[model samples]
Target: MTANEMTGGEALAHMLLAHEAGPIFGMGGFQLLPFYDAARRLGLQHHLINDERCGAFAADAYAKVTGRVGLCDATLGPGATNLVTALVESLNAGIPIVALVGNTHRLHSWKNMTQESRQVEILRPAVKEIIRIDHIERIPELIRRAFVVATTGRPGPVVVDIPEDIAHATYPFDETWFEVDSTYTAAPALRTRPAAENLAAAVELLVEAERPIMLCGGGVHISGAAQMITRFAEAINMPVAHTMSGKGSIACTSALNAGIFGRYDRIANRLIDESDVLLVVGCKLGEIATKRYTLPEPGKKIIHLDIVAEEIGRTVIPSVSLWSDAREGIADLLEVLPQDELKERLAKWAATVATRMQQWRVDVAPRLTSAEVPINMARLLHELNLNLP
Candidate 1:
């Protein structure tokens, strides 16, 4: 078919299907009929939602589960406006999505024109990118760019405004136009290891510390280094305390799990104050994580490891700052350490942590007994561990 023969809606459907977007979520309207028809013809599943808001939400949920660009579509004017709230939700939640909003014809572009709406302007601030396809020929490029922006960096939503008149207008189909890859492919910066001298110095401090604590954060999850952190903690026999966001990073049921550190947990706060060495991995000591920037005592030693250089010493200046990926850094450190001494230290630390945990259970047992509703913290932890992999 010639470039001028295919309708704008048909071009949109072809572009989306070419990109392998399985199904798009939206409530179809009169302005969106052409696009829906094209979608049906292409065998692309259309999730017919009761409302635009629900459709947008479904797209967001889909993105979160699949880790791919979620797609949503809506008609012009009120239909497009109804999706704003959901778009904002997706933006805040860090979901990758592309919202296809239909617009009025070019003749209705003037202000105060009936059913005229600046859909791009309304969605620009919230979405990562906004593309208004005034020309049908630009559909391929526009769709490609939309997917690129939505899935790159800190992924978020993007909007493609398709005017009704343009949707119905003819354009030639060209399969080759949509063949190029527009996805962001750059890998995350790898974590670098500390120098030999620096590693020796850190080990010296760790070896002499009487009471050491390992503080793990959400960075472990982001860096996919949770296993390394757990292994390193076990190797050094260190008690593992996590930030709110870092809760699931370590197996919560492990004897080494010292619980969360914050205003909400007084025991954890006391433990942090008592510790001599704090090994922070993949976690920035942000205001919330550090309880309003209050840190361990001055005499305490802090070793910080994170992927981003700037995040290394942000909250509390570390005695040793290692700008590296948490997982690899910890594994490398463990590999270089004296295996016998490390195992000995780990056993000692695990024993101490267990003793402390027993004491805590005894202290809280009286409260549990007095409460009208019996609560077993240990049972709850056991159940959760059993259910989770």
Candidate 2:
């Protein structure tokens, strides 16, 4: 064989390394043994998981934490089926993952072969896209496509099903085919800002409103917009609230931070009730975030910004919807906002949030210090908070 020629498994491993795809999580099986051997030989980091579901979940967590595309794999049949729950979780949370699933040989497909099942059909609904590899030569190209699809736009899991025969099949490979696009290596591969007209309209509402608050969600974390959001909130003197998943969008100690707003919150709901205009960024304002769709009261003007257009009006219709990445949208708003004109008018709202936050801390102080035998949940949380870096 020529130096450019390699098996499907070797191509997959080589492409993964070229793209700098990190830490693969999976449980090995016969159908994927060649790829596993290739990975081992290539010095790729493979984390052996106890179950396929756990592997998928670990990948999901890796994506969430690193703001990169997570990688996982499973063999045919039961192994592939086990990843559904975690794939659904990643889909709903907008996390990026690339799942490699092994399948039976093409000849045995639909012939009642052992561990033979229609995995693409089974996993379609659970992922953003699913591609089955029929030709060994397309392995590297398809792997690159999977990364692009998984990380770009509204990030989610993509499945690439490789048949056993394809994995072991040798083919003439071009060295140029191994080139990967570095842009799609991480989540939020592209950043987009809102329209100029939408930002102007949102600014008008924000300037005139006596009470305006911001609500953020997981999109803030995905876009790595924490510092930008904090700066924006501070500049406008606006109170900021978060969903359960959106916690830590802003520093907890920041006076503008109103804490979690949802089914179980501290002071954010109170602020939301009093707000006249709501600036929602990144969050979907789903049932949990909106307290079963009963938040911001009625007739409150809303300005919604999200990377996904479909999520903008799915729950609560916004007066202005900015379909853009979380960081870029907020950066554009900050750039155009008339900050000098509105400091006096919004300072009172900021003061009110700070006062309420202090009062809430006082009210919860006793509970946090409780020394009950079973150890109160609040006390446990307080201890954890103290130790957090």
Candidate 3:
């Protein structure tokens, strides 16, 4: 083949590398040899797993930790089928992943190729997009679109099925191919900033809230608003409660952290019941999160903030719904909301909440320190956290 003519596998590997896609993880199989060879030739970093299921999880984990689009692939037939579970999990968690799978060559499709079982049909329900490439030349454009679809809006997995024959087919590089930008990275493109009217509404509620509470969730971590959340709460003397997914968004040891509670948290339930106004940031407030829609209390004024508008009043209607990125929204509110005299106004209520939190620790301290054998499970956990900085 001439210099410009390269195998479809080479074109794919080059496209991914040009876009600076993150780690490529998968298991080896008969149909993927060309792609593997091209990846090696292009000096792309590839991770191997013994099982396609685990390979998908590993890629998903990388995406969760680094906030990048996960790159994973599986061979034709069984290998591709195996990646379905993790992709489905990613979909549920709103994690972004681009899955590459191999399929039977067009010539042998439905002709009973070994291990063949309709790859696209099996994976369609689990992913957001199913892009099948019949012509080898379409690989580059399809891959680009796959990245865009997987990372835009609510973020989920996209699957691209490259037929076995197409993977090995030679192609004269087309000049019409979109050149990947040098700074391009595999990440979502959702930009949410709260509207002025909504922000003002939230501020008005917050300013007059005698017992203001802040409830955070997984979206805080996804939007990278941990520090912003901490600053906002501390500035206003707001007590913060977290869901299981929202725990790491703020340190549990912080005075503002009222503790994780939704399902069966005494401290959090009492505070939620007593709060005059709740400022919910980045949380979906799902059933388990809001204790079957009971925690916000009856007719409590609520300001719900989230990137997806559908989640705003999915369960409990909010007085003000701000569809915006958690980090950006919090940062903007910080700019407009005054912090000087409000800390004094909020001191009594904030301290009551803080005292209740401390009382909870005191009430549980005996169980935590009990010398009884078999070690109380609660005590074991308390010990673990007691020593943590």
- Top candidate by TM-score: 2
Where model 3 places Cα greater than 4 Å from the true spot, the runs are: 1-3, 175-178, 181-188, 264-266, 386-389
TM-score of 1: 0.70
Between 1 and 3, whose TM-score is larger?
A: 3
lDDT per residue as tens, model 1, 7-126: 888888888877788568998876667889989998888999889888999988787656677889998777788888989977755467889988877776675755567767787887
Compose the digit string of candidate 2's lDDT tens values, residues 236-271.
798999998888999988888899998878889988
CA lDDT scores, all candidates in order: 0.74, 0.90, 0.83
Q: Where does candidate 3 have its weakest 10-residue lDDT segment?
A: 181-190
On lDDT, who's better, 1 or 2?
A: 2
Worst lDDT window (10 residues) for model 1? 182-191
Given candidate 2, what's the lDDT at residue 218?
92
Winner on lDDT between 1 and 3 is 3
- Measured over all alpha carbons after superposition, the RMSD of each candidate to the real structure, in angstroms, is 5.2, 1.7, 2.4
Q: Tens digit of lDDT per residue, candidate 3, span 139-219?
A: 888888888777766678889998888888898886457476442254446667999999999889888888888888888
Candidate 1, which segments miss by more than 4 Å at Cα? 1-5, 76-89, 113-122, 131-134, 180-239, 243-245, 274-287, 295-389
Which one wins on lDDT? Answer: 2
